[model samples]
Target: MMKIDIPTMRAQMAEGDKKRDTGLTEPTTITAIKELSYGPHGIENTFDIYYPVGTTTCLPTIVSIHGGGFFYGDKELYRFYTMYLASQGFTVVNFNYRLAPVHQYPAPLEDTNALMNWLLIHGKEHYVDTEQLFLVGDSAGGQLAEQYATLTSNPHYAGLMDFAIADVQFKAVGLNCGAYFIGQTGAINQDFPFYFGETLPEQTAQQFPVESFITTDFPPAFITTATHDFLKDVAEPLATILRSKGVEAEFHLYENPDGKELHHVFHLDQRNPIGKQCNEETLDFFRKFL
Candidate 1:
């Protein structure tokens, strides 16, 4: 496993994010609300909402989660992408959660649940159709999305976590190059402690064994990975497990046969044709659930 320097990696990503154009046009009909607090976990537990301008009618909601090896990233960094999704005629909720090495294990998960509860209570006010909700997460965030999906749909899994299964239900989920498998050897394995905290290795394994939580009730999924993405190995197996469980799922592998392959979360770069194509496909998949 590769050694990670979180600060350096974050700085690199921040620089890259600054240069990428969101490729979203004038919304002409969109409203963006920012920094809505969902809980007291910290300022990071806030979210942003975007939707059609002046629309009172309920609309499908797309809740997006950003990935940063469980140590970085926040809602602000994802604004452009989130707003672009909103301009496409859906209500989008992009949020920030407590980071690891500071907050640890279930903190992010709990923050997610609280956000859902907030949406359930306040979604109508923002014209969000609670009935038509979807989730989108990339990289480490993808792992959280998968975990949250299971906790919402699988009672047995929820019980193991010592919490009541959430009443929320997701219409579908878009997991982009997510790292679903947790255990590994090497420098990468060392990073687990930051998020899993001081929990026993066995307990940590049980808590995040995404594959074990799969069931027929799992929500439909739009899963994607790039030919060169580090997480490609797990992404395919996840989609396969979902399909095997009789859940509706689609797996897409973005490729570059003529040149170097796309990297992790390449979809964030709208300048890339392949990335743009993947985003369109993902949106189409989300629309099916609506």
Candidate 2:
């Protein structure tokens, strides 16, 4: 298993963000409203909305959940990429949840539930078509996305979390290099305590298995990963399971025969050519629901 030094990994991510900051550009035209609080969690529960500039037309909305091994990442780190999606003519809600090892499992998931409720109530003020909502997540956020998607449609799953799913219905779900499994203990994600809290890994897995929730009524999904991603192996099984359950699912593995390896959640960087293509393809998949 590959052990991660959280401190060093976080510093490296922040440094990368600094470098990417200077090269960031809007796709064509986009505007952002920053730091709007959605719930009572102070700044951690805030969200940013990005949409086309000077347009009041209701657009398909993409609610983005970011990835950082479940303990790191916020809307600020994801602004540029979300803005690019907005420029593509979708209203994007990029949000932050309280991090783990401090906030723990269901807290973040609860925050996700609350945010969706908030959007459903307040979305029209921003010209968001709540009926055409799509959920997008990367890496750890993918796990959150899958959970949220399932919770919204599965009463049993929603009962496990003790929160009713929001009234807003999802048009589709888009997962990028998602970490979808929590069953294995030796999967290089040793910080399960941050997510599982006092619960055992096996119990946590039983409670939140993405595969178990994949029924015919489940929404369509677009799942993407790269050959070099550490989480690559988990992607195919998820797509296969979704299909087996009679749900529409598409899985893409980005491979570069030229040997340029793309790591996990590469799409979040946006500078990677393959990542850019993957982002465009994911957005295209969302369009099918429209």
Name the top TM-score candidate.
Answer: 2
lDDT of 1 by residue, 1-290 (tens): 33567678789978877667544453556798878999996688888899978777888999998998888898877777777788888899999999977887777888888899999999888878889999999998999999899888888788777545557899999999998867533322455666665445565566655677778999999999998898889888888889999999999999976878689998877567788788888899988877
Query: What overall lDDT, based on C-alpha atoms, would model 2 receive against the true structure?
Result: 0.82
Q: After superposition, how far is residue 238 of candidate 1 from its true place, in Å?
A: 1.0
Model 1: which ten-residue window has the lowest total lDDT? 183-192
What's the lDDT for candidate 1? 0.83
Misplaced by over 4 Å in model 2 are: 1-5, 26-28, 184-191, 198-206
User: What lDDT would each prediction earn against the true structure?
Assistant: 0.83, 0.82
If candidate 1 were superposed on the true structure by all CA atoms, what would the RMSD be?
Answer: 2.6
Error of 2 at 10 (Å): 1.8
